[model samples]
Target: MTANLHLIPLLPLLGAAFSLLFGKRLGKNVVTLVTCGAVAAAALVTLQMTFILHHDLPPGGALVDTFFEAPWMKAGDLNLSAGLWFDALTAVMCCVVTVIGFLIHVYASAYMEHDENYTRFFAYLNLFMGAMLILVLGDSMPVTFVGWEGVGLCSYLLIGFWFDKDANATAGRKAFVVNRIGDFGFLLAMFLIFYHTGTLKYSELASHIDGLHNILWLGLPVACFAGLLVLVGATGKSAQIPLYVWLPDAMAGPTPVSALIHAATMVTAGVYVTSRLHVVYEAYPQALAWIAGIGALTALFAATIGFAQRDLKKVLAYSTISQLGFMFVAVGSYVNGSSNYASGVFHLMTHAFFKAGLFLGAGSVMHAMENEGDIMKMGGLRKHLPHTHATFLIYCLAIAGIFPLAGFWSKDAILGGAFAAQWDVKNAGPVAAWFAMHAGKIIYGVMLTAAGCTAFYMFRLYYLVFHGKFRGTHEQEHHLHESPARMTVVLWCLAIGTILSGFLGVPESILPESLHHFGDLLGEWLKPVVGVQLHEESAGQFLGFAFVATAVSVAGIGSAYIFFLKDDGVRAKNFVATFPRLYRVVFNKYYVDEFYNAVVVRPLRGLSRILWKFFDEIIIDKLFVGGTAAIVNGFGKSVKYLQNGDAQRYVVGVLVGMALILRVSTHYSAAHAAQFHVDQDGHAVTAVPQNDAYTTNVRFKVEWGDGQESDADSAHPRGLKHQYASSGTYKIRLETTDSRWQTTASRSETVVVR
Candidate 1:
């Protein structure tokens, strides 16, 4: 348990570096071997540590490795670290990342066998896993943020692995930019958390955040503001709303990238972070309610979009977005007035299983059909690819929440938790939570309907892709066959996992008294870190809600069977033609991308063009960059003319320069006379010196009417120099000359022949 934690992230990172540098030299096979082996090793260590934690430590115990003997980062009260913590929570995430990541890598070997950039693809995959592990195990927010940004970078790289394709590159940039909005919110939450609590460590924040619930920022609690910022990050990363336009477009990448980044690990980062910092949302029910509402709505919204997509991966893409919404709902629910974020993690794990399986199964279909991603071009695939068909069937049922499959248990837990959650939001200062007070039932209903939608669209995809008569070209039908053993084996493994992983979060409500302890195993494991408490509802009430969840899923499944499988999908097609406008709306994903482009992207781009033209080209380039060079060049040209060996020209240039200087430069003359003090006979003019001028450049002496000179540097004043010119007027003056012109002139402006 005290093992070096750095190895967990470092191994995959090193694998990435090694493969990238030498992968081409060593060949793709060797590169694949090293990258896969690195993850497998990390997975083994994570499992070993998980076993030790389970067997040796008390419930909620964690093994923390600071890596260094002392704290790595500290400044006044703001102490941070590059440490890793392995608790039950981290254990679940680590296993999901490494194990699933490894399988995806293995599957990719066969899936990408003929690709030329095999090594680059593996390198990005390795980098992604390493970053994800760091994110899961980091001991502090800063440490987690480092990993957070790392995965974002890796996603951009992996998603656009085929950079030659414009669409793939655009998809990568889209994900990068959208996540940045989320990351900014996350960064702000970190700053706000530190400002209020003086610490960003999860261990320290548990006690510190409770004190902030009463503190107000604006009109609402400071905790609410921080929680909202964190939720903003979650929505961006988890593909919730507004910012979710990027996830559906991410299908432009290779299938493994989709399965790895979108399905299993990278997209789940938001749920992981929220669950990790669940304490911040604890005291502010309004904040929690916001996340819950958004989650429920996004799930439903994405699921509806799924119903109209023709692309195999696009349907699954929307399904992934929809499922992410469920995880958010689970975390935000915080059921029964207690933190139940671990239930969200439970869904995250189960989702990694079925969703990854589904994506890979889709990949197998594409593999058999010559990389055709459109389900319209695919049907009767089940006949040619039986193993893939069987395994895909299991994943489909599991995702649809049918019966006791993996999706059913995890999704059922979330619905039950959300159903029981109490927002107490009536007292909230924010208007957003007005509907949250006693609104958990409505949220639950929305999630239930979304779950049903999930089943319908997934099966619609399944039926259209697997059940109908061969709709592809005759050449594709002739060559259609099951994928290689390497791929089919991974598919079966994931499918089996989708079946078994659900049992980890089995609700006690459905279990016998003797089996109650095992039913909530995942929840109990997270008790030490999250301390989530489930409300004990009567068995009948819990079972009744469970029945409702199951019935809705079954209804969706049955409906899909009639619309697609029973009548060869004629009804679905007829509905599409009859309701073309409505179908087009959903089919076009409600024009969200177009809306964003018109509203946000187009305006921003137009502004950018203006800035480039005026600010950059005119002000910066023409005025600054070009202006400075022009000045220097003009000076050089003039100097070169002067430096030409012509004496007459030089003499003329100096005279012209003097005349030009005289014309352009203005000169001002100043005259000052000391205050006159009259003598008794009025014959002598005595002068008192004015106070010394307040500048270092001024030093002076006064002259007396006796025609005597005085020391200019002396501190005392002499009498003013004066003589009666006409009646009583007197003036004094000093002589001066312009030596450069060799001319003399009167220096005094007051010398009027006095």
Candidate 2:
């Protein structure tokens, strides 16, 4: 079956168009219906297509549906089709983006009901959904980049939805500019890939992998160079480390938009893209390690930063970044002798469930607390918002990796894969072996710590907000109430997902021996697409990692309870009092943003000012735009003298112009532009004349200047020969004419016939 894959994205795009065009006239209710219905309908279509992909398609096959018979983009050797590619990987992403997007849409309908731009909000949401689906389903990289830029544009619009607020607008611009920086890397990688291989379709690129295998770019292997550039792009989209500053600020948008971005769309794009193009990374182990190291570091780094965040959304924002890092680690661990891409994607799924639920819960909390975001000011609201509290607790526990929850299974898959990693240090020097031997363990250890931090900050957010006495003002306290059914219904549904989603990916080693057949169905389902891991795990190794994972999760949760809730946070207070400097630093996000502002943002702004002054104002404006105008005006002034009612001067000018034109047209030139060979001890010469232009039909002749000449032979210009009597210097003459134009040109030169 063709699967009619284009309709999946088409539905939402149409909805966005309708919402933007006629939404105001139709009223908010109609806008909401079209918006949510479109995405919901797309989700249903995605489910149907996914079923078809799973049951009907052969292994390693796709159900492709192109929009037109001809290529959408064709230039010289480049041809790109407008099409949808349906495979196991795309199937998984479609479910995530469409399903989560639908939920966020439904939630937003209720969340933004009172907003003035409610219709516009839904329009942006639908647009975002459509673009993300395009990103997932595009048949080629250029097509994918269309969606890439589409989402980037939507992110700016959605993040700055409240344009009235200066900070919100700045945050949106920040996301745009930072993502552009990362997008440049993606663009460069595409250029390099296309340079080595003529096509950009995923299947075609895969087939042409060997063509790029041994090629080098800028002193590095092509694969390595491309892989590094790809990683740079992933870090920006996924919010890993240096490019991560934009995400925390993205909370300036509506909460539902935040859920959509964090769970469904933009952030997971990086991990998905890497998995989609794993062939590029297969030849470069160091590049793969760069991914793992960055992931491990970002996970730990973000988790540590999360510990000090007071705003509920900011905490989850950092938590999102940290979890994304874990996904990066999962995808990047191929060099560690494992291709746990399924685990990485699996984590993306589970994170969507728990994190979206968490963010929704935060939105719910904010709604009840009268829009208060700081958890430090929130306490004991569980009594008031019972449903929100229950779902929030579930999401919190799930994200903390409590057993039987979604996070545990996926996090366990990644860790198990990490532990099973085999470093190839054979035939290496001692230092190399030492580095290889310890690198895997070090990464594993950092991920473990990050996992622990996940539990710590999540529960810290939960306990601080839900467990203590009410701390807010009377007016805010009076406002506390459970959210409307429209919103809480989504919470409970996602809460159920947080509880049940993990079982689908339960690794066999974590289960009893009899349940082995039921375990890792996700891995089995995805194997045809992502392929099997590089290193196979023994039961003992997997089970061992699972055990440590549970222990660390429990320990982190326990630590949070003891420090923040057990004794009313007195130990936390004492610890903070003792380490105020450290606490302040972490609380301030290590001043990385400030550092960036000082080093990057400020310098760039300063340089931009210089460019605006010198380049834009002076060079472009004065020298180019104004100078052209000035030259035109001055030429007009100079030429007006000829038209000063002076018929005599006008006639002279016209005649002079005609003469120059005639001279240029009648110019003539010629050359032998031919080939000759000497033979018989330089006694004879044969020549082939390729006369220059205008040398037609008259004749072609040559004099060997050895007292011999050849007859004119324009009709048969190939052979007009003269024999040289001996090996010695001589003068040679060539002549040609165009009798019709009455033009003749000739050349003579000294020659040696030897």
Candidate 3:
């Protein structure tokens, strides 16, 4: 059964390939069937695998299957192979990705029916699902990177699905470029890990983390630098503070894309990576502190931005970032003496349900309104699109952390984990204790505030869009109708999920004594992979935190009702007018985009222009290009002097060259006359002695530049007929000796071989 794990992702990949290659030919209905069927089958396979793993596998055990194995790469003692790892963590992720992914695909079919590029949209969605599955299931980091880059490519394609819009294409490019920055960190961390440990396999790296931690690279602990790099990569994919700007603009893609990629699966990849590598983080207290602090800050910061957004999808976009921050808070809460991996994953799961529901519900509303995304232009939609209104309300209540729903259980677990860290635990180290004492309180406070802001903005959106009088043009009002049954069906399914998924992570402290055993089911299921920890909070303490969270949510909801429902926008406008500067800043997303343009983008462009002008155009071109041309032209002119096109002058020059060579040879022979024995005719003597030896022999050998040599006797002492190889210099040597072998003379001269 584990061997079949490869099929889960392969199915969606095949669907994407088919849709991309033949979608137009197959028509829209067949395209939808292929895409949705692939995801649904994947979901079913995941469910079966989850059940089998639960029933058969022992606690704290995993099953690794190498469906296809080849030597991907090897360096010294390190080897990485492409494979799949199926465990409790992967099982949970598979369920979330495939189930929610299938639901989004189903919803997209109805939402995108009229679009000409509907098939292309489904193809991109399937590709994203397949890539995300590979990311979760890959047994090694390098293999996972293949999927990481795959999803990034799919994101660019999907985000700019309507390439006719410049803004959409620009948004896609922004997402790709920002993610590349994070991926650089990811690639570096992988290299450092491989350098130290000589392997990138997840299991090997996990087992060797302790041994490798002390190995420093660039004067920092390997764990610290590598862990921080991983966090940097997470910040980009998970939409944490500095790298989060791309997500809100990603709403330029279709609404289902917003639901699937941004809200549910892709954005949660950073949390998954962090959770998957819990061992590395657990060892570095400082790294854990950074994760906690950053998570808390990003959570509060994004939620505050959400307060002023008028665009419906943009509001949900910021809301996803804020909720992801809460998950990171759970991830970073290890300083409390518990890793809280299960809590982070629990929130990831529940947030997927409610957030996906919310985004899809927004899509339903948009479908009805002819694509009006501004909530300020929408009102009193409850009477018109009752199903969408109700489902959207349920999503609001769930995400607002109201009791019994998914958000309340998972979010409170994280808050409780943060609170528990404040309690001093023996042997947990002073750093952990100090962080729990000092930073924990601040994190808790900020996260609590963010929670209230979350409820406020969500309800504010709800009231302004569904409760007040119609605020848009009459034509839009007339067009307001419930989405098709196909879309609403998925919304209702996700709504039920929002209501029920919370039970999987219910805290034992919050349950009655009779039901305490059933609580924390998610923790138990995940304990085999992530390890289990007892949070150990009393009933009173749990109740106290739960009450505070619920009160803040109710307060936010009440404030929204008062401002938008009862006061008819008078107080809201006055509040904005009173703090115009602050309102404008928040409304404009703190001008972070402008800040980046000024500090990073514009400077890079200016530097590139300078380099192009001075280095490329002036220095490189003038020195290399123009100088080479000038030198070649001068050489051509020098050679042209020889090409006078006069046959008599060319022959005269050759004869003069031969006379010069003979004159030099005669001068050399006269300089050493004792070595030359003359014949009776006063000519140079040449003889071949007995026993194959030469004595008093005056033989001349003429060598040509063609590497051919010929000997000339005393009768024919001129140069031999030989063809030159091409064009170059040649050397001519002469040797003479007396019969008594008393002296030997050798002379050499240079001549043109052309």
Candidate 4:
């Protein structure tokens, strides 16, 4: 069974390869069936693997199956091997990938059947699924990045799958370019780790932390830098901060792609990365704090953006971002010295169920509308598409965290983790440390506010799309048939997951000791990876907290129910008419997008244009590039004088050079002799003195005009050969006058040696 785990992701990879290579010859329906069948087979195999894992592994055991390693790379001391890790986290993630992915693929087959590009869509979908599965099951970060980049490439292809449409192509490019921003961070972080640790293997890096952290000044700073880089990667993949602009636009693709990538699979990579690096973050709480802060802000920001969206899928996109924000919050809470791995991973599971359902239901709506997605044009759909309406209703309640549903369980668990994180600070009683470490009053407040907004906006979308009378033209209304049985069947299955998945991580308070046994199944399973902690909140406190959280969620639902479902006037008009400014602000998402466009995008474009015009074209050409040309020309002209080829002028120049050299040499030698005598005898040594320190003689062979050699054996007159017994100076003089034109010319020569 352990070895069989390798087959899970491989099946989809094979299916993708076959579909892409021979899909056109196979025909669209065959392609769809083949891909779907392959993924379904993979899901079944994963199910068997999970069952075996449950039966075989102990409470805190991980089943690591390294089936193959091709020795990808190895340097002097660094080695990285490609393998798979099918531990608790991998098991849970694998189930989600194959299961949810299979559902989405099935839904897409039916939803996309009308399109001519159905075969291509399934190929991309399978490829994307395989890449994501590999990402989760990878044993090391490099292996994970391979899958990371694979998914991004698949997303760009899928998002732009309908490339004939300009908007769709632009949306695809946006997803690609924006994600690159985060991928850059991931690459840089890998380099930093490789430089310091000399290895990229997760096990080796984990064990060598002490060595890396030994230089607090160097290590801490580098750790923070690396962590921040990884977070940037997370933000891009997960759609945080500036990177989130692409997700809403991503709806330009088919609704099913949006559902699969944005809701269930790709965006969650950030949270997965953060969790995988829990140890790295544990060593640096400050980085974790930053993570939590950014996540909380993104949640609130995207939720607010959801309020203003008119398109159904765009609203869900923002909603996905907001929900991901919660995951980040859970991760951040763990960083504050608490163990909320169960809570964060718990929320991740439940979120997948509900979000995937929501997206699929949205797809069904679009399918019925002849491809229309705006909620304003889609009223009175509940009665016609009863299955979609019913499934979507359950998903809405779950997502709104309504009582007893899966969303309520998972979401409140997250809030409970947030509260647990801030317990000591808020309690201020006996558990002061827990309170101080965990309490984030401001974060909780914002989260609660976002929760309210989520409830209101979701119900608003629900009512606008399903509750009112049909608003489309007669022809459009005539086409409003239910989605295919294949789509509906998957929707129902996902609705069940949305309804019951939370039970896997059931709060211990709900199922007391001896039977509070959900703990060992996932909590203990993930203990080796996420380090689960058995929460000790009293049963009474747990009930009280659950009750209050449920009450608040219901209140949000009730408020939406009254405003949209009951009072139809509020739905037609503005609910916040009394405060037009506030309503407008809420509708505009506080203009964060506009601000980013103006402040960030505009300036970047302007600077890029300026750089292209000035530095790249003008300065670079003129100074760095053109200057070389100028220097070459100047050298050519200066060397032209040497090419005159006049032998007489060359001879005169050489004689002048010889006279200058001899005069300079005589002056330097006399000065040296004078200095030696000045230092010892207070007089000059006019001859080569035997007692002097100058002993060795150095001779030069000179070349004169027209390549003629000077006579080396010639001796100066009057013992003026100038030899020094030691290292000192002497002068050589040839009798001559100082006049250049007296009779012929009185020649003189001066030579010096030392």
lDDT head-to-head 3 vs 4, winner: 3
For every model shown, the clashing-pair count is: 1, 0, 0, 16
TM per candidate: 0.76, 0.76, 0.75, 0.74
After superposition on all CA atoms, what RMSD does each candidate show versus the true structure?
14.9, 10.9, 18.2, 15.7
lDDT of 3 by residue, 458-482 (tens): 9989998998788899999888888
By summed lDDT, the worst window of 10 consecutive residues in model 4 runs over: 737-746
Flag regions of model 4 displaced more than 4 Å.
Answer: 65-72, 168-170, 217-221, 335-338, 422-439, 512-514, 519-521, 575-754
Q: Which stretches of candidate 1 lie over 4 Å from their true place?
A: 68-71, 168-170, 426-434, 533-535, 579-754
lDDT of 1 by residue, 209-319 (tens): 755676787878888889889888888888887567678877777998999999999899989998888888877766887788888877887787776678999999989
Give lDDT per model, in order.
0.77, 0.79, 0.77, 0.70
On TM-score, who's better, 2 or 4?
2
How do the residues 126-167 of candidate 4 rate in per-residue lDDT, one tens digit apiece?
Answer: 989889988887777887898999998898888888667554
Model 4, CA-based lDDT: 0.70
